[model samples]
Target: MKLLNDDLRNQLKEVFQDMKDDVTIAVFTKSGTCNTCTETISFMEEIETLSDKIHLKKLDIENDAELAKAYDVQMVPSIVLLNKDEAYVGIKFNGIPAGHEINSFIPGILEVSGSGEQLPEGFLKQLETVKKPVNIKVFVTLSCPHCPGAVQKAHKLALENEFINAEMIEAQTFDEISNKFNVSSVPKIVINDQYEFVGNQPLEVFVEEIQKTQA
Candidate 1:
C-alpha cells in the first residue's frame, strides 16, 4: 500500500514546487537488520515522485561503510540531505521520518536545496560570532509532536553556521546511543556531546545553549 494518499501527494507537489535547486535525499539502511529500513526507503521513494527536483539515493549502511562514515551515520534508516552540488548540508534523519516528525523532512529539503541563506537575521548575526564547531544531536521518537521543532532548529543552525553539524536520531531505534546519552524523554537535544537538555526550546534559548557550549 502507498504511504502518501492522493490529497497528501497533491499537497506535497505544491510544497516541492518551492524547491529552486536540486535536492538529493540519501537513504542508508541495512537490509533485514533494521525493522524500519524497508519502510523508510519506500517513504523516500514516494517523496521523490512528488517533485522533479527531489532525488533519492539508496544505500546499505553495512555494505557502504565508507559512505556511511562520511555522513556520520552510525545507524540504519538514516537520511542525508544534499544540495544541488551533492554537498551535505549537515541535515540528517537517523530513523523513519514518520508521524509528526515527518513535518521536518520537507523543510530540511527546501533549506538544503536553497543556499540556506534564509535564516533569521538575528540567528545569522549570532552564528557569525562562533569560532568553533558545534555538533548537535536531537534524540526523538516518531510519536513526539515536539520533536520536529527541535530537529528543525538544529538543521537551521547547521545551515546558518558551517561549523555546526546537526542530526536527528530516533531514540528507540538507536537504543545503545540513546541510553548512553540518558535519553529517556523525547526531543532530547545534545550539543557537542557535552551539554544536553530535554523538551523543545525557543529559538533564543536554543541558540543560547549553543553559545554556552562554545563558551
Candidate 2:
C-alpha cells in the first residue's frame, strides 16, 4: 500500500498550484534520538515531493541556533509556512499533518498564503499588529472531559490564525508548570505568561484575549 493516498497527494498539488505567490516551507530539525525528530523530517520531505511551488528549507536546530530562534522554534521539527514577504504561518502538529487532516491542511495553507477570498473581517489587522508572540499555556489533565474542546479551539486559533504561542501542557504530569502557574483549576488558560483565566470561555473571548496578548 501507499504511504500517502493518492487523494491527499492530489489535493496537495492542487492547493500549491492555486497559490498566486511564492510559498516557503521552512523546517528545522536536529540529528538525534529526540522525540519525533526523524519522523517529522521524513514527513516534511515527503511533503516536498508533492509541490514544486513550496520552497522547502531545512536547518539543524542546534547548529542553526540563531535561525531557529528567529523562527521561534522551541521544539524540534517545527514547520513554518511563509508567503512571499508576509509574516510566518506557524504549524505545531503533535504527530503528522497527514491522514484526514491533510485534506484541510493544504487549503488552509493556500488560503493563509493569500490565494483565496477577502480577508475575514479583522484578519488583516490582526496579522499586522501581532508582532510579539502571545503565549497561551493550557493546563489540563489527560482524562479531563471538558479539556479537549478548549484545547481544540486554542489549537485551531494557532493553526488558522497566526497570532499565538498556544501550548497544551499536561497538567497532571508537569508538576513544575502546574505549581508555577498555580493551576488549581482545570482548563486554566495563561496568556502572555501574565494573565490567567480559568474554565472554558467562548471562542470570541479566547480570540479577543489572544489578540490583546499578542499586542
- Whole-model Cα lDDT of every candidate shown, in order: 0.88, 0.63
Error of 2 at 43 (Å): 1.5
- Tell me each candidate's TM-score: 0.94, 0.63
Clash pairs, candidate 2, are none
* Cα lDDT for residue 48, candidate 1: 95
**Cα lDDT tens digits for candidate 2, 154-192:** 655665555565655556445575799998887788888
Clashing residue pairs, backbone N/CA/C < 3 A, model 1: none
lDDT of 1: 0.88
